[model samples]
Target: MDDTPTTTRPPRWLNDHEMRAWLGYRRMRALLDLQLARRLAADQGLSEPDYDVLTSLSDAEDHRIRLSELADRMLWSKSRLSHHVTRMQQRGLVTRQECASDGRGAFIVLTNHGMATLHAAAPDHVAAVREHFIDLLTEDQLRILGDLTDTVLAHLREQPA
Candidate 1:
C-alpha cells in the first residue's frame, strides 16, 4: 500500500461491480420515468405530480383526504402540496375545506372535475405502466420487487434525516 497522503476528505468508495450495478439502476429508473412522463403528457395532459395527486385522492375514501395526508402520500412537503393544490383548485380540479374536528386541520377534497380527469387518465396510465414497466416483469418478479422496495422504504423511514 503506497502511503501517499490522501486528502483529509473521506474517499467516496464503490467497487467497479457496485458502480455498474448502481449506474444500471439509475439509468433504468430515469428512462422508465421519462417514458411514463412522455406517455402521460401526450395522452392525458397529466404531469407526474398531477397524476400523483389524482391517484392519491382516488384511493381515499369518498375520493377525499386530509391535506396533510395528501402531502404525506405524495412524499411532498406541505408547502409544495399547497402550491400544487392551489393551482389545481384554480383549475377546478380540487378544493380545500376547514376540518370540522380541528379548526387548523384542512382537508383536500377532490372535485368532480378531478375525478373525471383521473378516470380519463387511468387507461393511458395503465397502458404506459404495462408497456414500460410491468410488462417487462414477471408476476414473481413484481412481488419480489414490491417486497424489496417496502423493506428499503421502511429502513429509510426509520432513519432520522
Candidate 2:
C-alpha cells in the first residue's frame, strides 16, 4: 500500500439562520405529511401510498401505465411497487394486464372503484391541505416556496442515482 498522508477537510457547518431554516423545514415536512396522511386515512380509508398510486393511474391515458414507468414516477422500487399493487389488486382498486407486445411487461390499470375513491377523497384532501399549510403562507411566501422546491428538485435530479 502507498503511504500517502490524507488531509481531511473540516465540514462547513450551518450557521444559526441556516440551522433554523433547515430544522424548521424538516419539522414542517414531517408534520404536514402526518396530518395529510391522517386526514386521508380517516376520511377516505386510503394510505398516502394508495392515494398516490391511485392519483397517478387516474391521470394516465386509459387510466393505465406501464409498471416500470409508474414505479419510476413514484420513486418506488419495482419489488415494493409490485407488493403494493398486489394489495391494491386484492382490494379491487387496481388490476394488472399483461402487455401484448412484451410478455414480461405489465400495465397498472385503475379500476372504476379506484377512480371513485380518488374522486371522493380529493375534495377533503384539498381542504385539509389548505387548512393546514397553504392557508398559513402568504402569496409571496408560497411563490418563494415553490421556487425553492423547484431549485432543490432540479439539483437532486442532476445527481447520480
Candidate 3:
C-alpha cells in the first residue's frame, strides 16, 4: 500500500494585509517580552519566569498551589517548574511542602519574602508597562486589542488539545 499522504488542494498563502498583521504581532510580542524581562531583571533581580511563578502563587488561595496544578496553569512541564521552584526556594522566595493527602504530590508556597519582593517590584513594572505599551495606544485601540485577544483566545480554547 502507498504510504504518502496527499492534500486535496494547495495551501492558501497569506496576502499582504494578513502577512503584515502576522509579522507585526510576532515582532511586537518578541520585542515587548524582551524589554519587559530586561527591565524586571535589571531593576528587581527577578527573571520573567520567577515573576510569573510568584504572581501565580500570590493569586492562589492562601498563596499556595499544588506543584502539578501550578505547572499546568503556567503551561510548563513538571520538570521545568520543579527546577525553577528549586532556584526560587534557594533564594527564600518560596518553599515546597509535602501534600499530606497525596504522598507523591507537593505544594509550592510563596514565602513572605516573595510577597515583599512582588510588592516592591510591582510599581516599577506597572510604570514600565505603561511607558512601553499601554500609553502608546488610544482608548479605542486598547479596547479593540482586548476584544481581538479575547476572540483569539476563545477560538484557541475551542480547539482540541
Candidate 4:
C-alpha cells in the first residue's frame, strides 16, 4: 500500500447507468441459463453438456467429428471430452472409430439412437428457448443482441490466446 501509486488519468469506468445495464444483463443471462438447463433436464433427461455434444454431432457432416476436433470445438479439455465420450459410448449414444488416415486420430461418431434422441428433443428444446428468451424480445432487440454478441465474440477473439 505504501508503494502503490494512484493515477488521475486512469481508463474510464462504467457509469451508473452502464453498471445497472451490465449487471441486469449478467443476472438475466444466468437465470436464463438455469431455466434452460432445468427445462432440458426435466423434459429430456439431458444435461446442457450432453445436449451440446449430441447437437454438435447431429449438425456434423456425417454425425461424426474427430475426437480432438470435437473437444476443441466444444472448448473442453481433451481428457474431459475423452471421459465424456467414453461414458456416452457406454450409454450406446456414440461410438469411436479409428481414423484410417491417421492412426493416432479417432472419431466420435454419434449412433443412430443418439441422432434420433436429438431429433426428438430438438423441437421441445427450441420451444423452451423461444418461450423463455426469444419470444419475449422484439425483432429489434434480437438484432441488437446478435450484434452485441458478435462484437463481444470478435473482441474476445482478438485477445491473446
Residue 9, model 2: Cα distance from true site in angstroms: 2.0
Off by over 4 Å in 3: 3-5
Kindly indicate the candidate among 1 and 3 with the higher lDDT.
3
lDDT of 1 by residue, 13-54 (tens): 999999997898899999999998998889888789988998
Give all candidates' CA lDDT scores. Answer: 0.89, 0.96, 0.95, 0.90
The sequence of per-residue lDDT tens digits that candidate 4 reaches over residues 1-161 is 59887668877899999999999999999999999999888988777888899988888889899988889888898899999998888878899999999999998899988888788778989999999999999999999999999999999889885
| Residue 36, model 1, lDDT | 88
- List runs of model 4 lying over 4 Å from the truth: 1-11
Give, for candidate 3, the lowest lDDT window spanning 10 residues: 2-11
Clashes of 3: 0
> Model 2 TM-score?
0.97
RMSD of each: 4.4, 0.9, 1.5, 2.6
- TM-score of every prediction relative to native: 0.86, 0.97, 0.95, 0.89
Local error of candidate 3 at residue 17 (angstroms)? 0.5
lDDT of 2 by residue, 1-161 (tens): 97999899999999999999999999999999999999999999999999999999999999999999999998999889999999999999999999999999999999999999999999999999999999999999999999999999999999998
